[model samples]
Target: MMYTEENKKEVILFGYGKFGRHMYHHLSQGGHHVKLATMVESNYEEASADRIKDIKRFNPKHNDSIRMLGINPAKHLLYCAMEHTSNNLFLVLSLRELYHDAMIVAISNSEENTRKLKYAGADTVIDIYEASAQHLVTNLTKPAVAEAISTIFFEKNNLKIAEILLESDTLLEGKHAAEIDFYGRGLILVAVIDREMGDELIYLSRGVDHKFDAGDTLVLAGKADDILSFKMELAGV
Candidate 1:
């Protein structure tokens, strides 16, 4: 996608730790304006100050400290990727309290913390162990598919992995997965989270044919435009 100043999102990333740094780099490379915030002075000093527009110190306990950062909740995407689960939870809670409608994405180290983070008002919670394990499993079982996913996400590509929920009115609801021509539509159907199978993700790489149903989520990798077009076509929009 061609990024212009008006189209680019402003990203506010808290904590300059490992995960924070990774997100900063990823967001920056994706053409979004990224600002790094950390509680530790050393982390602030270690960050790439030249590339980032602003680096500020924020205190999780102080609401005013966050306000001082001048984050516009509606326009900015906030990331709480601190190394400690406590800090992430507190950051999410504090941010939610300050900006009730802010979009906050937090990282959790465990399933228990994932639930806590969601309850703490995080808009999205990424489970670190679950994500890492999924990647490991994919690499072990299907190296080629793993590489494709990595290239789409990590490389300079407009392709992205998105979960498209099948609503009741979708045209594909009653069709078999193999009957739909995803590749012809410029999309790769990676897996399907079958609602009938207790939301179990059945990987399509194994050549399994699944009957599409409402409430099932299709995991697809493709360009943003193609994905949007596919959804629109499926919904007959």
Candidate 2:
């Protein structure tokens, strides 16, 4: 019984709180239509109703109201309103058995609540403190690399591509980029190529004169489809 991650279906995100807002922004930018549910209509408006609509009204205190939202659950659901509560486990158990084939993503600050969310059938449980800690570490230790990764992974509209190093007999092992026809490969940016160019330290797209090593990772940029096809074609080459 595999659950296909279908992007075409609707997603319902509970809790119009801070973490919920952040997740909504990410998914929305990734082109997901998100519907929100809140305990009160006032809290919903306070969270900025204009940025998002398609909200379903519900309250955490009222079991019936939560059940109503769960009965015909949206294809994807994320519960993020439990941060202020001590008995968040009870709420997860309350809504667990009611949803259909929906993928439930729960966000919790406590490890105990994460366990409860998993036990109650949440597909994924995110720990708030843990995520924050990791983010802090990255921001401190690797700011530049982190920014590059964010540009590629988080910014959906950007045409940045990060790829693993590949070595094959067919590839042009020790050739300069000026020798290769990049237009035929259809890459807008061959940003970096991992290479051991003696003391010169060859990085690609530094004007394309540097030679490529046999086992060098090549960072590139293009439309998602184009980059994918380039990788496939390069695999054969």
Candidate 3:
């Protein structure tokens, strides 16, 4: 799905430890309404005496779009960044029991826990170590590309990378990637995930032609507005 400012998700983070704290800062700075959800609210004060001040402090580096939220079951997206994999799994399970439709993204520090987290009802499981190694590799081998990626991720801008799955009735079905003219529409078609090919996504830069099919997820990087518009166009919504 597209990730524009208007469509930015309201996320409830399940921990406030090192990883949780950093995630809170980054996502809030990125203009997402994020709330810290602990087993107890006082954990905030225990974790950081200046937690409230820090949360309320407006970073001059970021725009006024940064937002914070309280625990609300209505909030649809949950990010489980607990320090322990077991805790993360339990938290995901509990949240799943509460919000059946909630979109859960759980962080896994171990390979074994990754599958467990997914089976526990997390829609997506992120491996911290794997991601860190990938990031390090990118920085070491492709500094320029890494810098550009950092600008999109760390800095506040209209640019964003999003993955959108095409449904059976999508307007773009049956078309080739070259026929879509993504650049003309202000988007860079980065890759296409082929569902029928055992989850192997074809990157446009690989010099391979693709026939757009239903259930194929298109990964695109572009300005938030453009990305949202593209998603809408494909969905014919």
The TM-scores, one per candidate, come to 0.68, 0.58, 0.69
Return the candidate ranking by TM-score, descending: 3, 1, 2
Candidate 1 worst ten-residue window by lDDT: 1-10
Candidate number achieving the greatest lDDT relative to the actual structure: 1
Off by over 4 Å in 2: 1-9, 47-51, 61-64, 70-74, 85-88, 160-223, 227-237
On a 0 to 100 scale, what is the lDDT of residue 57 in model 3?
22
Q: Rank the candidates by lDDT, best first.
A: 1, 3, 2
Candidate 2, 1-237: lDDT as tens digits: 111133234667776667667777666665666777766566578656555656677766677787676545544555555445443555566666565466677888878878867887777788989877877789899998777656765665535454536575535567766776766766654554455643333455355565666666666655566666666666783
lDDT of 1 by residue, 68-97 (tens): 999899889999999899998999999999
lDDT of 3 by residue, 1-237 (tens): 224556577777767767787888777766787766644345566546745333322111222211233334556578888776777787778667756777889889878999899999998998989999988999999999999988776556778788888889787888887788889989988888998886877887898788888888888888988888887887677
Model 2 CA lDDT for position 96: 68
